[model samples]
Target: MNILPSYRYQMADHKKSILIFYVVIVGLSLIFGFSTTLIINGNDAAVHGSTSGNEMATVIFLFVVGLCTFKETFLISLQNGVSRKTLFTAKLLTMLSVAVIMAMIDKIFFLLYAAALSITNSQVTASTFYEALYPSSTAGAGPLMLHAESFFFEVLLALAAMAAGYFITIMFYRLSKTGKVIVGAGVPVLFLMAIPWADQYFLNGKITIALVKLILTAVNTPSHMAVTCLLAIVVFNALAFTLMRKAVVKQ
Candidate 1:
């Protein structure tokens, strides 16, 4: 797989995509980090609390990195010569792995920033810092990693969302020229709408909210809210993938 044309194809496209992704990632990080530093340092707000800017950035970074990496994973799978089912499985696995790594990196970066700047309360030690950073879910498990429980549901949701996107792109690839325009514009608009709807309907309301909160927090944490978002993305991806698999490719 390492030297496969599929892998090479994926990597080649990612060169440009990764550059663009990095630019956005760095820009967002700087903007959020600076704003957080200013707010924490300037305000009389409790630094160690959940409302910290650093905390917000940590969550944002996880999501941004997860989605970004997932896109690359999907593109990479296209380069690997495989059946649609195989591609889907490989891409989903890669995306999940990326999400976990991104979460860890975001966590570490947030902690280091807090420690270096002394933005946290003096009472919060490094060991306690992690616990506070990743508070226990209502389920009683502290968090995914470093804990006995696995975030399997969360992982599944992330893969589902990514699969949905890959399928959507393939669907677009099969469209007539006019249909392509409709899809290009329509899909993103619907996606934008879905973001808030997922929050209002799934994340905060109904059995979905309780189910998630039971397993994770729906508050400010990424780990808390990501599974919900990923599920929404998954619903779209499943439909898209099904359609794409049936789609007629001209090439």
Candidate 2:
């Protein structure tokens, strides 16, 4: 039998044309980061460098990549004779794959740069490479490792964001006059549900901490954050697949 049309649609998307642009942007960031360090510390570049900025950039990069994938999903769904479910599944898988790959490349760059610095400074500690990629919690920032077990939670969160965006778009398309009000109302509704906050009566106090710990254990164990990230890839793709399978295609 011929391959599914949904998969074909993903392959046909033209946004891959932007891949070169993303690569150039990332390359420039890397060079700029390295150059900034060299400028600040003179020949002793290790003394003034940081991966935190790059890490944040990677996150932003992933978000943009997510948007591109969303565009593909939307276009695929609009195709004639294509099953909505199949279109969704294919695009979800594509997005998850792209996210995982980008995350890995980002982490690799972070670790390599960190390791180089640590070696140059002769300040190596018991901290593993994962810690290098995701620094310990400190003021003003949270842990950043999207590893193996916690992968499910993070990726699911991302997929939820994507779905939520698409749903709002659909709602707006269907209800032009009330679209703004509906989207404004729907955004906060979805945000409160997906984001794990402790002030709520249901998620407050020790229960919240317990849930957070459980999530940490799943996504990151102390050694390989990649595993958690991979798991997330699977989970998010699965969720997107399910959502698409059940979505009602209009027009």
Candidate 3:
């Protein structure tokens, strides 16, 4: 089969979920602003505006999509005689396209949300996850540069998240039932229990502090974040392709 069809099919799968996601995010935000205004301003709740980092939700959503989209597609493609490389390539292209589209949509929403917020109640201010993290990094940049940085960060982070999800699905596909159960349980145990216990008792939180510092240093600027995310995306996809080569059609 043509790679274009696979690419389009993958994108099509994401389309409905994305629409519903935006509808819910925007709808909930509207309700929040209106109700908050109504309660505080005593019936003067006309189109009040607020802001938060909605892009985080998009990243998480794309990750879940990645985790869920693989099994059926992989099974169907192998049955239809599509090679693994073509499947991987199509998925890569689809993830990149989705990242770009979602990034654009996210930035557009942020601008519109900001504009709307400016016209409404000034009691609450606007901020973003990036701004909250690196408050001084882009404070002196031009409007175009600021937006470009934000767009790049959105694309890169979302892309990386999607790649990680795909890698996870491929890994799970390759694992046996018992292996799957062990991994599914072990990962949470490692993070939620072992790691915390080690960091707290054995390492005295040094590991946790070091990790926090590493993350902060790596993402101190948009360019830094871009590089970090690109590396992660590359590693995740490479591992995924390796896993896919060994993935078999399960009954």
Q: Could you give me the TM-score of model 2 versus the true structure?
A: 0.51
Predicted structure 3, TM vs. truth:
0.88
Point to the candidate with the largest lDDT.
3
Q: What is the TM-score of each candidate against the true structure?
A: 0.49, 0.51, 0.88
lDDT (tens digit, per residue) of candidate 2 on 39-98: 655754444434442433434445444544553456445656556555666656655554
Error of 2 at 46 (Å): 10
State, as a TM-score between 0 and 1, how close model 1 is to the true structure: 0.49
Candidate 1, superposed: residue stretches over 4 Å from native: 1-81, 119-161, 181-237
Clashing pairs in 1: 6-79, 6-80, 164-237
In candidate 3, the residue pairs with backbone N, CA or C atoms under 3 Å apart (3 or more residues apart, or in different chains) clash, namely: none
Model with the higher lDDT, candidate 2 or 3 = 3
The sequence of per-residue lDDT tens digits that candidate 1 reaches over residues 154-177 is 343335445555555566666789
Better of 2 and 3 by TM-score: 3
What is residue 34's positional error in candidate 3, in angstroms?
2.3
Candidate 1 lowest-lDDT run of ten: 49-58
